[model samples]
Target: MGVFDSHKSFGKAILYTCSAESKDFFKVYESSDDKNVILSPLGVFTLLLLYAFGAEGQVADEIVEFLGAANKRHLTDSYRKLSRELSSMDPDLLAFSDNVYIDNQYSLNNSFILNAYSYNSEADIIDFRNPKSAAKTINEWVSTKTKGKINEIVSEDDITYDLVVGLYNVIFFKGHWAVPFDESETREHCFLTDDFQLIKKPMMHLLKSLDYFEDEGAGVRMIQLPYKESKFKMVVVLPSHLNGLSMVLRQISETGLLHYVNRMNHSEIVINLHLPRFEIKSEHDLKNILPKVGISSIFHGDAYGVVNEAPVSVDKAFQQAFVVVDEKGSTAGAATGLHITYTSLTPTIPFKVDRPFLFAILYDDIVLVAGTLSH
Candidate 1:
């Protein structure tokens, strides 16, 4: 069957895949003490899918399995259709771009490159040995794609002579709250942490009727705050207890997350929201994280198929993400880059992310970006 024929199922697969990956990512990256982290699991997954399309044998097999796609073609075709559907969307609310840079010494499979361009992802030939200039060029492409919010995805230190191919994806999002909080109502509020420490921060306040739910069983409350067109939303899942974030995070599995979202669809209530305005900028090397998520074959394996007659394996994979929530709306941008190296929620109810909590920016049911706030 065509991937698009099962678009609904494919979308669910994407959500489940990302949810599963996010749990692993949370344990490895966000589990540290006193860390605020944001991750674009969608961006990371897209780059990995592209690499898999160009790969063969065990590398492709593993990635295809991880992506929950029947095959590489199914994955690319599904993304191409998704991109087309998103192309007609409001540009200010969402922007997506993908790219690949191959060293001039190697030859890429034209079919694979064609699939990339079909989704508006361009392929450029560059000299990886000249890390300085190459890094600048790729970074410029990233900056342009992300409207300058993400200025650089690759630094000089991130590039090396062994780098054969680089695959990158950028997703930029800006959404205004359907019912915005008044700036005048914002006040300094005490936020309690897991350690029982309290800190004062600017807390935005609003009393409005919103889509809300409280799962007492999970000890969490959820709220859906829509953006302008209502095509996308920011969902917040706030733990009932001040120090219960760890429990909520630990319980975030694909099944549990889907259950929470399904439950939210049936509930609504008036909420006196007290949300803190916070900014998170995170950079992570997926070398440590992707392997934990069952994507180990691309790192040190004899990965072939993308290039002809070349022995190349992934060297490094990185992702940079940034999100800012303010009185008006939210602006988020993320870029995932792979250097042949390979690669790789929430709520609201009375939701005061005053302390630490989890949040997600989603287009319908698909989570585009997600993170934890531990301050």
Candidate 2:
């Protein structure tokens, strides 16, 4: 799949809602004092969709509404197809995996098991009471799936006997730049933050012809740096004003994201790019954030259809993300876990990222991860 290929497999509503959810999640994550943040909204959505399959009543309704699906079947079919398509994507560029772990106390649903497999995923029955072993097993699974980029996703503290099920999602990506940066040109440069503080960092320099755009209306400079596979790229949005990151975040939406892609110019020109080599490792408790985006029912409401026994509600949901940007390429890994304890072308313009900014790693219309760099 080409980076600019049409997203015909996915519904427009899915794309819109996913991006909106990503932005909403970003809002919650940005409130944290730690400046650097990263999240895999797509991964989170997929896991929730899997939960929707086993959900009924208000739980089903809420998850369906938040996912922008007309019904549960619609959402499931769409996610099934999406899983197939994403798994079929070039592995060298991206890898995605999902797994479900249910406590042996409950009988697993055959349909749910089959559906998971159809999506190139699997399910397992584990003993939640044995928190130490269960946590280690879950962490090992995540580490193996993410090429060791992520680990300890579910600690002993996250496990309990009341926990009935757990869903896991991991997305790993490693793609080389279409035009690599010169290592010799990398130098120490001062990065100004929103608070007017400066920190010297190793800034990578590259002069190349790349997809570029300047959105005056949004007051941000957008640049697209494609990967060697041409199916993925890092789109950076740098606010024109040093302290304008909040403004850009306030104005960002699904429309804004599409605008970035639509407004991108393929015309290549000499660009003096100065991007800092940075590594961001972030962990977020999304339990509080999902409700803000119209997904409140699962936290406290009765969810009926998950199993044959009794009603269940999600207790813990979180995400851990890792991203590294440097002269060579970008490598990112994200894991979204649910504990049922029941849980460019840029132009040659001076594209120096010397301040707080936002970035999206995109594949077609789907936002694999959305993040902010305030430091």
The per-model lDDT (C-alpha) reads 0.76, 0.77
Highest TM-score: which candidate?
2
RMSD in Å for all candidates: 3.7, 3.7
- Span of ten consecutive residues with least summed lDDT in model 1: 341-350
For residues 1-375, could you state the per-residue lDDT of candidate 2 as single tens digits?
432233333344444433343434455555567868888878778888887777788878877776666778777766766688789876656889898888888866776677778889878888888999889989999888788889789889888768888889999999799888899999999999768999998999988877788878778788888888756788888999889877776666545476667677778566788998889988888887787777777777765656667677788889899899988999988999876543304334788999999888877667787788888
